[model samples]
Target: SGVSCEFEENPCDSEPCLNGGECKGSQEFLHCECSTGYTGERCETKIDSCEPMPCYILGTESCEGESLSYHCKCLPGWEGNGIY
Candidate 1:
């Protein structure tokens, strides 16, 4: 006689990973691989590069921050890329 077994549900079926995180594993367990600029157990936290403020003269108000880098806004009368 052949034996029959019940099917097991995958833990990742619910898609627990958040914020562009990739889920890996199977019915046993799952983990999240967060994308750039994001961190935390579920990738919910966005890394702020401007916390320390790298801009000089113009201060943090004119500081443009990204995931891993920052740019300073040009002073008044200055032209080119600082307008944005």
Candidate 2:
């Protein structure tokens, strides 16, 4: 006796993705969900920390995060850090 395997193409049943995501087949009847700034169906968005933020004030080029938000640290002589 011989054993054989058969594979079927099953599309996603329910689309539970956000931010322009696509529905693809996964292990179960669920999709791999993808989100903005990410590719593939598994919602693997890459966060680039080097990106510039508008909260930075003059003389300051970057900002740092505290707990739940971020704050700008202006250089010497600068007025505001733009983060308050």
Best by TM-score: 1
Candidate 1 whole-model C-alpha lDDT, 0 to 1 = 0.72
**Shift of residue 31 alpha carbon in model 2, Å:** 5.5
Candidate 2 similarity to native, TM-score: 0.35
Across 1-84, the per-residue lDDT of candidate 1 in tens digits comes to 125546677767788888889988777778889999988888888887766765555432377778887776767765444322
Candidate 2 lDDT by residue in tens digits, 2-84: 24546543555445555567776654566655554555445555443334464644577567754335666677777573564
Candidate 2 wrongly placed segments (more than 4 Å): 7-45, 65-69, 81-84
Q: Whole-model Cα lDDT per candidate?
A: 0.72, 0.55
- Give the RMSD in angstroms, all C-alphas superposed, for model 2: 7.6
Query: By summed lDDT, which 10 consecutive residues of candidate 1 come out lowest?
Result: 75-84
Candidate number achieving the greatest lDDT relative to the actual structure? 1
How far out, in Å, is residue 10 in model 2?
A: 8.7
**What CA root-mean-square deviation does each model show from the true structure?**
5.4, 7.6
Q: List clashing residue pairs in candidate 2.
A: 32-41
